[model samples]
Target: MAQSPGDGPKRVAIIGSSGGNLHSHGGDDPARLLADIARQLDAAGIELAAVQFVAAQSSMDHASDDTAATLWTLEPAGPAPTAQGSLSEVNETAGEHDERLAQSLRSGEIDGLILVSADPSGTNGKAVAAAAEVRAPASGTGGTSLATAQALGVDLVAGSGTTGTTSATRAVSYVSGLARRWGLKYRPVIGSGPSTVAEGSPWRRISIRGIMVGSIPAFIAMALVLAISKIPGLDFLSPVFDTLMEGLPIVVAAVAARRVSGLGEVGLVAGAVAGILSAQGGILGGLVGGVLAGVLASYLLTWTLAHRFPATTANIVTGGLAGLLGGLVVHFALAPLTSAIGDGVKTGIEALVEFNPLLAGAVAGLVMWPAIIGGVYHAVILPLVLVEMGEKGHSFFGAIDMVGLVMVSLGITLANVVLPRSSGERALAASGAAVNFGFGTFVEAAYPFLFADKRVFAGALLSAAAGGALVGWTGSEATAYLPAFVPPFIATNKLGMALAMVVACACAFAVTALANLHHRRKQRA
Candidate 1:
């Protein structure tokens, strides 16, 4: 409960404030930084709460394809420069600094706040300064640069406009100093970036224009659309080619991707197609589609190259294909249904925008769960957050727009429910949790309780369906702050909005229990 930064006696969790570092993919400095921080915290006998990191940056013109610079900020839970990262690879992967670490943060559970590696400035410093100058437009130039940054805060500010090493060093100094003045307690770890400072990999950042421009709000508006979509004539998503076609490029590319099992021209072509659709939506959509096409095609190609392609690569490949297909359905079939609902309760639905906290909390809780909650959290909250002050993906609106969360969430939750309590279950839970937490950002806590009994899936699946239906019915926008690479629409309060899920859980529990009992009785007979 110690509130000050660098306070003693607490577990320190290091939060990565930046994205992939393109500089040296061979050497994982950021990951080292995280481990080092964890070691220090553990050594201190204090627990690390959560690490808040921000990788915000800016570019001069929208057209320049050069590296976009970043302002990487890491929040640790102890003293500055107080014994950070290990020099070994054992402490590198993500699991070491998760959950137990994050949970500590949520409850005011930290004893100290340590600042680790707060690097500033980059090649794009000039452009960033220019952007900052015009950040508010009417605000004028009285420290417009600093003022813009101050108001934008660490979460919102990006220091990617620097020209080279010198400016980057200067900017990092200014940022670190300003942060300390603002009480951020960081180590100011300056590194080299042709484009920007990186947390780990250089290729992980997303172009967030679409969701940043109101994806959550837009999708919240769309959630209403989902509700109405349930109405026969109101569903606009059903008959449209967009919803289903959304998955097409991936499907088509899957064929070629699977052919070579490598990130061939087909994969790049898929990426291009997705990029086009995203540009159509704005940077938000572009980032989502582009990332998906890149990752999927790239991964498949890797597998193809290794000559160890999965026999079921087809299923995995089709999953991406299914996304566009689902989109087409939502646009063409389900969309009109929403219109019908809207017509009936247009006034009522419109009046429901009070930003209900209970609903928000529940949705947030769902998002906080292991699978969809934590894994995909990056994708879910990124669009809205812009920074952990910003680290995440799809955001809120991006969440609802993409059908991926649903597919992934269902896979995860169901896996939790259906799998027996064995090493397989444990592995499934781990994978599911990681996917939802690391990649999808959907739900988190539910897995444990649901897994308490196998019958839990019936309730879990039913609840998941209800939640999905609620989202679909409401047309709630989801992709905002984060990028899932596969496109996402989960939100911060996503946990709260998944209310219908309660009933689904109840249904699943009932069905599962009854079936179990029935099987038992038959055995007795």
Candidate 2:
């Protein structure tokens, strides 16, 4: 038996033999063969309590009618087991044997169980069923099985007895790996017994929804700021809007941290720290600061709770202290690091525009589709675009935005209407078209079509590049920094905007519809 480093003792049982006659240089002795297998497992860091051998009835030869034959038995010379007369007899006893195995596992007498088979078909139908039944709900531990049969629950390693020692080695390795996964999934919390908390850590259980919810406030703020900017006499409120816009990253960061940590107090602290950092380093700073603060706060909170602090005050005191310390650290230490980053981004964008505005516009258009899909367009990229917009009346990014939100979406919608597709898809296309044309928000409806097919994405990219190039070549500008759905015509003259839109829509429609038609034809052929 071998003890794994950093892990407590684990009792394991192996059922089934390598099969065939036990062979070694010394000669054939089943006990020696079993000992050899156990030694191999020990060398591979597997601790084994016992090995049970199940020999097929067909493989055995009866000596005489009066002699009691030993067909199956435990290793290290245990009492000879009664031989089953037939396959049906073995199957009949499987249920009772499986129940006993399950009881041993539940009672913690056996920490792990391995079912080895000399037959590649996995012992027999009856035996496999018996192994599977051990993982049933009635056996306790929910449906968590000791074996990986059915691709559900914990995975058990299986190997063929025919493959010899190599297969046996693999089985040992698999058992070791399974034990490691089990420990990770069921590790006890610090300062708490194993009986207190269920399997899996809090951090491991966090969902994507938590992260998305954090970004909601920032998204809403973006829409509201742009919408308000369109109102007359609101020009005086530009400073206020700019402040909120700059602080949006902090809000996003805080919310995200809160969601991930599942601690409202910690989230608020993180938001405050991120907001302070963002004020100095801009949007990038806010994002980094929020993550750092949230992580630090979470650890502090966990420590406080684990120490048996009064439940009522633990969250507030620990969270507050962590936030205060984290905010101070970020403001004094990390804030200066991000200032250089912000400055470098502004400088880089300016240099790109100066070098080749047309090329820059085209590239921005090409990349915007992926950015939109990744949520970066709204979170990080769009804010940078706004920075450029504030300096100049418009940005090359705006052209890409215009093409992506309006023309590309419209083209895709048209393709859906013209091509053969499901009624559900057509309806979605119609809805997207309506939203883009009516409300000027293509994001809601456009994403589905863009992501539905690779051809659609390619069409959108080409269309965006064309529109972006046109905008750049014409030196078209937009006065208002609105969402992508708003046409460039609002800021630039109608003629250039219209020409770009026409080119974009045409390219997108032709590419998408033709690709779809070609696919359909190929399928038919």
Candidate 3:
């Protein structure tokens, strides 16, 4: 029965279908699915006002403007109202024309909307905005759709047929519960809230500066560790340095998270959990664990504080519980999962290196450029190289990897110097050159140029690959962790190292120069 608009029960509309065939199941047909959804709504004492079926399409962007067909609309009469046409045309004919579908939502006819799509993109920002405009609560089932809904400040609910029969039933119940709670004002529980800081805002810039400041301690520790390892008879301090390296990740994570969250204690605990996870799983694991821990701690603390408990007792209890839960989960579950993944990666690298060191080195070098840019090489791959170095007393892979990075940085610096766009650019390039040659950390300087010009990046990548391959082919190794660009080759073949560096520098310089020249000519034209 159609419930009156002013009735206590909420009025809702279901849009889209599951976009999957039921395979002779009773719920296979679109009409059946809509009926089932309506029944669910009825059970919850919510009135199902309408069902809008949008034609299935691989890409939502390609869906026809007239694609939506109103299959059913509730009425007090004998038969439900039905309409067949392009959704755009139907809306246009109604004399309430608006360019975006969201404009229709401003009518405030529906109290709640359920968007059921197989994919998230099926329900675009327009639909979400419309829901928001009317202050109508909305929910979605699919991951993409749900994510979109969340990002756009809509409530989320599970959908049917995706997981299993049991899950489908649970999803229905979940939505019903939400329907029961419709009287309450809806606010997104997850994601960045309204009044988000803009990307270029001074606050965001300050956060970036904070991150850089926080990183300095870890950087100094690493450099100290590397320098100490190179000195003869300083091997006794290796464990201390290794401990520093391991602990520094936690400190950095804590400081960064604290700065971002403005929750110092919770951020520290989260960072500690992440550091431990990282030690177990590597960089990627640590990052995941840290983020999870931070969010968990923040939420728990916020929830606890909201109840007006004694401040000291509440903090201790909430903070302790949050840390315990986060630490346990990461240590017991996430650690093992990340460890397994790391093992698989290590196995792959070993197999490839055994098959052909030169090919493996070249491939690794090629891959490293992207990995470095993506910030994965340091977190995941570098640890494996370091482990191999420890086991074998030296690592050909390490030598090639380090040398390739150094050479590429040098190449980028030289490019800027040779083809200065401005006096400021030239000065910046010179500074980068100093860092690359003196400190062996060129990432800060090189990234700007690499991202600015595709041709220059390509040149650097190719050069690095060639250098890596040559180093591997020659079986070069390094006994201690030393800057690839520095003197005193340690246990490595100095001659081979020198040759590889020369080749890498020459290739990088030549390619970058040509690309710069081309760019200049294009500018002139």
Candidate 4:
């Protein structure tokens, strides 16, 4: 039950095993173990909250020691940081050790847990085993101890190693991996500590990366709508998918709010309010509203806390004020501005296509892949495409994307699978291609080869440019992002779109296969 600062890093509890057949299993050492764990967590932008050592002295009596006297700050733990001095060598036999652990899990304070137990029969091991049987609340089942961790959304990682340092290191890797996947970063505590350094330009993380993250659910919903339309009975569920698509703004706001403001309840409330009020403006509006709300709420909360306001009262004030101010700003000012921008973008593209369709198409196709690489396709280009499709029932940009990016990527993947240097590579390439086809929202299937050689990527881009030129010439348009096989069925210029895709695929395939062959020959020489 240690206290953390208002804007502190994530708090993780460390559980360790001791006593009971300790020698038969590797002996538990306090020195260097907690230090390594702390250091690892710090590197990942997390902080150690508390450490508890459990000893299963007998079936009836268990001994537990709470050794985390020092409040582990955000500083990196030195190499020799030890728990020996502060850790009570208390062999106090208690039957309530499990209850204490369970209480910690039930409390909303701990953000994550690390369990270090080599033996399955040990106290720590037993707790871990019991957690496996407990289902999250979403599944409608629950258990005690570690089960509480699962239900409460506390991330848990079990370490794997004979020694304490090795096991802790392994566990830290999992925590780091999860943080990376979620785009979580450790930042300095606001207000009191050293001033937090500013992040990179808004174009990189805020506009591009944040919008991309927020757009994922919408993209998935779009894919589902396309996939379900082809299914027989599932067409009835189209409304459900449509509802999800309609709430795209809310989804974007939620993600944006949580990312900008910590996972505070206030930020979510503000984001939702802003999103609901700004729904007419689409994803662009949501992005602006959510970021505004989150920034306002975060700073308000900090100021309230600094003034020693009650936590609950501070949170209420923050959410209320942020929602009111942010919603007003978006509704009266930013929403109309964003809508105008989206309209202007669509009109410009349409005019370009009208003037010289071939050149326009070629240029669009050539830039599409680079934009994806530069992280601008989703943030800047997608909102325009979505707006166009919503108003006109189809999008020319979508047509270009399908053939130039998706189909070309597919072609590169097929080439690798067909002319792979090894069996493993062939298998990998095939699976990657299958995944790309199944998802139809990304071109990651081509990433391996794209990064492996510049020539192959250049060839793919050129082929896409040529295909795009044809699409422009034919004036193809699509209502959705579809797989290679499905696009022709839904596109405005069916035969033309098909032809463009085929040409793009064929050119990409030949270029990639030849590049692979050249590389192989050079290796032999």
Candidate 5:
């Protein structure tokens, strides 16, 4: 049953039917579909309470493993939705199980439900009846659920050929709309989706977003500790700030390892040990060591499991050995190689800035988004930025990024807020703009618009190039992550930096507004 507006967070359950099978449609797997639903619900300010697997048979063996796996994947996205623990016994008949589920829903134990079943005929009649009894929306991959939804007059049903994702999206949209109509209060969260690279890439498990997210705590701790220590009475806290900053590598390593290995406490311990040993090589070294250790540990665990080794023994030995080996490898071999490469890249960038600041800035700015799109930003650019920050107090290249990339992205998002064709787009753009301005570390808020149209992408590049050129000509550098507007005040050439920001932002805003206008007109036609 639906809760009233004053009720706390609305709880939802995902019911995956045992006999049903959801196949990959258009390169999106079932797990991805589930994750997408979670993201959309997060955006809609709804709570995904739990995922329940139901089987008609009187045995647990009939439950869908696919659904269980999907739940596992959703864990890393944010908070893991609870699994139904008080479900009926495996020996219970289908009718008994359905009754228990219905009791939960009817009693407001579960506020809403999303039913996923690929086969039209496979949806449990009892479950459908239960949802109908509560006037809950029915959504799925086939006509059976569609008929139920149509009868409910919800218009939230996906077509017969539609994927589970399509159904989930429509259902979430309807719920969100209903909430809005009822004047219900729900706060939308940003960055609820897992910040993972696409599947199939070896490093797909190495969430670049996770790395950045994990560093936030350390950054905050340092900021607070440093600020407090500056007080005359609290000067002793200064060393605490240094110690906290030094622990950042360990934090990053543990996060990276967990994202990659998914191994519980063992992974964290291994990653921390590997990270501490490789700290001499810098944060990059810790990251590399952690990832390497995670990979080896995962492989070893897999092998041990196949050989019938004890789980505890296998995990301990593999984790310990992997950490030591990974740390040693980085310290002895990769450290020197990475240091030399970092120096060389730094030298090349310096020479480019020296030769022609304007051209260098333009080139850097122009390629920023492209490199991000091509996945080079994570593998190449970020490491170099870290290198520069470690050696010099400020980074010239990073300065261009602020003026060109960050500012341009902000400009495009701000334009969307002014001239968005849809309320959803406008709201998202507004949020994106706020987040971008606040963090200045991420530009993902602009991704929807950038990926939606090539014109926007091109406009962003050109705008960023203009800004980068100005930054180069002025020789401004940035030392910290702050709003794009704030960089100029701290820059060597404040006036030039300001000019560059204005030009880039203005150009991007104009280009995006024009592109949006064209798109809106095209849609009307």
Candidate 6:
């Protein structure tokens, strides 16, 4: 369902099937209301695939007159709809308009469905009553939608009650349940469909692993992950994890256990082993132990899922990424590179912890971002590379943390694969990639302003590389895990590394933004 582990994306759609006569909160027509709603949702992180207009009348006059400005991220190929409001008037009957709705549903090309004022009966209370034929189909229609959605195995719902607030609650509840059941952590943000309800969760879409992506496959994968986690054996702290690992040799080539999603248990083992290794022998343990654990887990899990869900371009990509990047290779690799790229920084960090603890701690706090970037890379990207690399090291699943080397190498071969198309997107994507590489986790810190109008994804990388470069130059080192989005683990030479990191991040941000602005100006001309 998702792309490779290192890859992150958000995609969504919005539509209103309410009768054309429905009033906007501010009294604008449905089309105008829709434009405003889509804009608002975009701000909240739900990138709309399209803002469709279904109203009193359907014609080119309404479609051509769409004045809503659209949003274009640094990533998307082209401009996105802002006021892309169109008109779809009453059709002769419900069955006649089935294709229109079906086509609308397909346009989003997403995993879940979001309905605005889903109750057709409530939407055109007066109109349908006036037209006996239209009214005849209303009540029965809602019942049919419920049955069809269930039979099709599609989880569909509206999001408002007062303005359909009940639908909103229902949608959130259903979506959350789906995530829990499947262990698939993905939240497809649907804004203003049932009205502009602010989301309680900080992330619009998040997986069982707590990562976010709006893609359909990603969501399904999340569901699968959640389901797998519940198995008696997959939970790391539980004895089941040990039992499963011990049985790797036997079950390695046989069938999988059923309690958890076939693969979640294996993922848990890999992740848990990686954690244990990191704590045991520092970076070396993390890389080597993690790879061994991951390889073992994959063998067992693969045996289990062999015929059921099987591996895919995406599944292998995400898990393999986690194996290689999150634990060992990068952890150890960075330590060695200190002399060349990050030099005196390490000594400075060490000294701070040893001598000037407070100041050093503050510096560590500052460098915390790189630590997070670096850490997230360990947790995600490495595992993916482990599977994709599929070379001699294929058996060494745990050490796949070494596979993170591949993501960087991809720059030479597949750099353009997930790279931002525009300057803004590049800044965001780059920052995210860099942050993942340097600090260890959470792409959120760099995602904003990435698609914020101009293409800024490239800027993120410029920012990240700068931070990483400084770490290389200063030779700053983190002890435990690179402090994630929160902070770094204690270390010496903290202040120097932190200062270097700051300068690098600043440089990256400046360079990327400048380049993007220049590009945009040229394009406008």
Which number leads on TM-score?
4
Error of 5 at 491 (Å): 5.3
Q: Tell me how far the alpha carbon of residue 9 in candidate 4 is from the true structure, in angstroms, after superposition.
A: 17
- Residue-pair clashes per prediction, in order, are 170, 1, 3, 0, 0, 123
CA-lDDT, candidates in order: 0.34, 0.51, 0.54, 0.59, 0.61, 0.32
Question: What is the C-alpha RMSD, rounded to one decimal, of candidate 4?
Answer: 13.4
What ranking emerges by lDDT with the best candidate at the front? 5, 4, 3, 2, 1, 6
lDDT of 2 at 351: 80
What's the true lDDT of residue 509 in model 6? 45
Write down the worst ten-residue block by lDDT for model 5: 65-74
Using lDDT as the measure, the top candidate is 5
Question: Which TM-score value belongs to model 4?
Answer: 0.60
Better of 5 and 6 by TM-score: 5
User: What's the lDDT for residue 340 in model 1?
Assistant: 42
lDDT of 2: 0.51
**lDDT by residue (tens digit), candidate 1, 19-72:** 323122111233443443344233224454454332223212221333333222
lDDT of 5 by residue, 305-402 (tens): 33434333455666687778877888888877655655676688789899998788889888888887788876666656655544343467667767
Query: Over the stretch 86-113, how does candidate 3's per-residue lDDT look in tens digits?
Result: 6455433322211233444555555667
Please give, for residues 138-214, the per-residue lDDT of candidate 4 as tens digits: 11101133344444443343212232112222333335433443346632232111221243111222454655545
Candidate 2, position 212, lDDT: 36
Candidate 6's error at 109, in angstroms?
39
lDDT of 1 at 404: 30
What's the residue-level lDDT of 168 in candidate 6? Answer: 22
Residue-level lDDT for 214 in candidate 4? 55
